[model samples]
Target: MRRAAQGMLATIALALLTAPSSLARVYLTQDQALALAFPAPASVQRRTLYLDAAQAARAGREAGGAVETRVVPYYVGTAEGRPVGYAYFDTHLVRTLPETIMVLLAADGRIRRIDILSFDEPEDYKPTERWLQQFPGRGPGDELSLNGGIHALTGATLSARAVTQAARRVVALHRLFVAPFPPPSGPAPGKGDGAPPGAPGAVRP
Candidate 1:
């Protein structure tokens, strides 16, 4: 009986080690989470993003630290077989706990929404849904920081920062790897906006 109990204990321990740590006790599964972002999508494309040494360095630069995972599971949400948006959950180390945050990007690669999949930190450390709302519609070049643009949490600075950094990394990755992005086309040549270079009928000396 003792031997059998020991074997069961060993099996449990092994499962814990091999399972995903970010999704620790989370209520939402991958499909459900994706559905929240995209309702009735035609299909979800699954891909894996691999970062080489140089790529890792660049991603780290954007993240302001080493990314928690090198290999990321990427999902493309499509409708009618046309790509609508991109999404992927990344594990960010919030102090001691690695929290899973699912970032959704628009077709233009801007952050559409952020969902906190799982976090084991204290309740006080959890950023409220309103606080989380501040992330949507923010682009890669936007200055995303705790005190800079985003409101700072009272005592959850680390958690806030971790989430912010993760957002930046996702945007950076989109620009770096995700492709066929067109340059920001300006107004037609010889056509200017905003007062048309001067008032239409302004008196000139």
Candidate 2:
């Protein structure tokens, strides 16, 4: 009987070893996500913002979550010598794994689009496109929490919370850093334009 029990354990281990893994997946790259967020833009420029301690604290309070970093990177899209939109990428853990998403905002500070760049969780936990549609046109003042204005997913509670928090954080960051100062009109500065790095007009290489 002991030998039979040992054989059963070995069989169980073998079955576990042969089972498929739900590992990480790269659904889109930065370039692809940018294209989708800002279709047909004349130019796309990258910029960063460095928040002071006070600013960071206010941002965290506004977002209802911790602001993990003081250094933030955002993108600006332009067309016909006018600002078009801004985009921010946020990556956070869903359950025990990570998921990266891009939150694109219209010039008026409303959420324009959201795209999942990568996910390191089971596919079942990933939110569907239909569910994600609720984010667009939402702004900093909108209720983005689950069951507030956004509906909850049946089985993906962690994912839903992470995404909702990300959206709120990005919008709060935009209101604090980007909305107050609009990018200068006309073509964005090229390399060596002499704008200090992390300044409003600074461009990312």
How high is each candidate's TM-score?
A: 0.73, 0.78
Task: Tell me the TM-score of model 1.
Answer: 0.73
| RMSD to native, candidate 2 | 6.4
Model 1: per-residue Cα lDDT over 83-143, one tens digit each: 7888878776788767888999988888899888888666678777888889988986787
Candidate 2 lDDT over 1-205, as tens digits, reads 9999999999999877654324458899999999887788458998777766676787799899998877788888889978789989998888877899999999898998888999888899998898999999899678889999999988999999999999999998777656745334423332245656654434443
How much RMSD separates candidate 1 from the native structure? 12.8
Which has the greatest lDDT? 2
Give the best candidate by TM-score.
2
Model 1 spans > 4 angstroms off = 1-25, 182-205
lDDT of each: 0.71, 0.81
What lDDT is reached at residue 161 by model 1?
A: 87
lDDT of 2: 0.81
